[model samples]
Target chain A: MRKILDKLGFTNTNTERKTVTFGDASVVSAPGGRGWTWLSVGFFIILWCLASIFEWINPIFWPPIGAVWEQFVFIFTEGYRNFTLLEHIGLSLYRVLMGFFIGCLVGIPLGFALALSRVMNRLFDPIVEFFRPMPPLALIPLVILWLGIGESAKIFLLFLAAVWIMALATRSGALATKISKIHAAYTLNANKKQILFRVILPNALPEIFTGMRVCMGVCWGTVVAAELVAAEAGVGMMIMVASKFLSTDIVVLGIILIGVVAYAIDVVMRYLEAKLIPWRGKS
Target chain B: MSGLSVRDVSMIYNLPNGEDVEALKHLSFELEPGELLTVLGPSGCGKTTLLNILAGFLAPSSGKIDFDGKEVLSPDPQRGMVFQQGALFEWLSVEQNVGFGPKMMGRKPNEIKAIVDKWLSIVGLADFGKKAIYELSGGMQQRVALARCLANEPDLILMDEPLGALDALTREKMQGLILKLWKETGKTIALITHSVEEALILGNRVFIMAPRPGRLIKEYSLPFAEQGLEKNTREIKKQPDFIEVREEILTMIWDMEEEIMGRQEGNNA
Candidate 1:
């Protein structure tokens, strides 16, 4: 195994190995158990234990860590045998991704339009400003009225939440393009369309990516809100059902799942940003 | 039928609060073919305004910019400009930035490649073709900007203090390259600079302007027109008239400073 690991380029000759119980042997490092992550987990466990034994507080309101884990296992196995946690998570992810992509399709060009043309700015600025300030969740009732309680209404709500952020970011980014660069482009005899595509759009990509991140966060938050009203099979629906039954462990488990998923999406987006904007970070 | 002609050009800025500021007043100059004309002045002297008009980037409120007896209305590849900040596209590789002009003009890939390669060699950035703009030093970026402009094969090149951002050493190096390019290409060049020495060093004819409603004060022609100062800067410094001309230009600028200060004081009173 050690030889195979070395051949596969996993060898770390600098480290010393130590054998431990539970039939596990591992390399020992001085920094082990000294990181903030370990301390944070230890504190979380202590808090969970203390909160569980208080007894003065209702158990339904604050479940113990073990209880939450147990509920998570139950939901994965017997409790949700018909429809697993993964199924709910998959549905939620689909909704967010679909809405987010739709927002990008509409938002990026609209933002460029706002930057490039005064006529478009005048025509759309008032409507955009009015809608931009209102919360996307607030439009849920109107959306449902217009499109009914189907996937369309929920998707529309998510798109509405994400689009404004993307548009505003793109417009600002386009406007921030250096005049000198534009003049240089002009002197090169670049046509209007060429200048817009080659110079303006690529320069705005970094800012556009920033807007996409904010839009994603908003999309995630609004997905829960959209599901809260009438979702049949989503994480938000699971939490709402657990709330009514006073199942604190299930509620905690759902909340943890949502947080973890959101964190993972955020990490992925950050990685994408680093890859796409390699030039921006270098300077 | 001059290479470039500023035919009694004037510019007026209508301020947001309904006030009017006259930036340029009857600015007229003519560039003979293959002449390097440098304009020198204090800040707000419309040095840039004059260059912009000639480059067709801006329209004068009065008078006209004419090129080869035709009225210049808009920017064209025939009159290329190199800006002070390099103005390189950060996203493009060095070759792409240099090749941008030809590509946009719909030149064939082979033709564009030839032009890009030729200018890149002249600027001494031949090996940095695939590198990103941000990867280059300030001096290298400026050289790329030069290469980008030159690749278009412009009849008249307008530069707005193109080497102002460089350190003294880099600026001197760039000055050398500019003189070499001027000699080899023989392109009609109009460069705007605040540095009197820079104006004196590069220009065949130097036009010194007065600040605030900028108008040309005087034009001086250098005696050593064919001599390359980049190579013989020390010998030029040793010349009898070089120090005298430098001091004369310096006094002209100091007088403008006093006039501006006096105006400011009167406004306070």
Candidate 2:
């Protein structure tokens, strides 16, 4: 029965197993693990197909996978609301990148100031602590009120999302520098400027990269949500418009696209981090 | 006056609860140029505090430190320090780390490279200069630290349990390298260690401290360091005189630890 089950693919027969013993006591067999990510995704798609075929959910609420695919193809070829799908993605990415870059530009210096100088920390720490906890989405109404419902408003919202996180991350990074490293540098005849630029800055980089990754994620999320409330062209606007017209297929497609794009951005950021800061956790 | 001198140096830490902790008290010592001095004591004996003060990372509550006829006020290029571990800058490669002091001093790139190369080879890390600090083992990292400190050509070097993190085999090997560097460079060195044998093997003068006020209790002038420079350190460890001194120091520290333990228990009672 076991052999038959293995032949039927009910068991992972190809996996290699080895028993590892610790000291003179317990031994446990562990299999060489491989990810089954795509398999689980395929299974979910099949389940969705079955649900649609059997009318397990209302078709309007949960459209057939075929309908979503057709919407994707149509948007890819014929365009949507006078802009190509790529154009919409590009416009959204442009806003996120601009806000993220500008936020880091302002926030990283502020973080360094806060960390290095007691006066700066005392002055700005309360303001940062105040805004860091408040969600960027909560500021949408205020941002629109100040800047109006345009690119500036959306970009401003994203900036707000990224700035505080980057600032906090940079501050912690600078503060986390080991005292011995500073002492060693000082004893080696490093002046204050050299210590700040060489020792402190480099020491703070791994933490700053971590902050950047977090900032990117928050900015991506904020851009989508901001577009849902305002903006003429974006993935979130596209989804909102489709939902208003009850075109669930386009809505589903937009949601999936958002998830895939966010995942891709995170993966790229992780790859960059590994390449730039190879000694991150090793020390 | 020509080398390094500590006159009645004392460090008192004021606790938040309005109490005073005397970390070091009336610590007086002198290390001449080319002398290797190793400090040995149990925990809370202010050995680290003394090293820190000598490195100019700390100012004693009262007392004075004079090096090379100058009062030591702050950390200077002339006084280099080596921590036990995690003091290295991981962001820089071994070469960059070794060249840091010179680079900071605005030396030419070529000059810095030459200094780095010379020291890297001295510490036996010549080939590993380009490697990131994290890629190296514990012993290799300490070697880089040593090279980095030596590359600066400091007048004095302060080491705080530099080999404490290494395994027994690596520690022994590093001890030999340290002795070689000391002999060749002729720089005054003050090293702190927990091991009595290490103190005996490394120091021309082994300064022993006692806690409960953290004062110097004993000082021994040993010939083992000079002898080890010529003979094997391991073989020197097996010598009759070396064993005798080791046992004596061990008993001294053991008694101090027991006394501290008794005092703590009495305080509780």
- TM for every model, in the order presented, reads 0.90, 0.93
lDDT of 1 at A12: 49
**Top candidate by lDDT:** 2
Tell me the tens digit of each residue's lDDT in model 1 across B191-227.
Answer: 9998887888888899998877778899999854456
Consecutive 10-residue window with the lowest summed lDDT within model 2 chain A: A24-33
B63 Cα displacement, candidate 2 (Å): 1.4
DockQ of predictions, in order shown: 0.56, 0.89
How would you encode candidate 2's per-residue C-alpha lDDT over B69-156 as one tens digit per residue? 9999999999999988899999899999999989888899999999999999999988998899999999999999999898889999
**Residue A254: error of model 1 in Å?**
1.3
Give TM-score values for chain A, per-prediction: 0.83, 0.88
Candidate 2 local lDDT, A185-253, one digit each (tens): 999999998899999999999999999999988898889898899878999999999999999989999
As a TM-score, model 2 comes out at 0.93
Runs with alpha carbons beyond 4 Å of true place in candidate 1: A1-34, A46-58, A77-82, A281-283
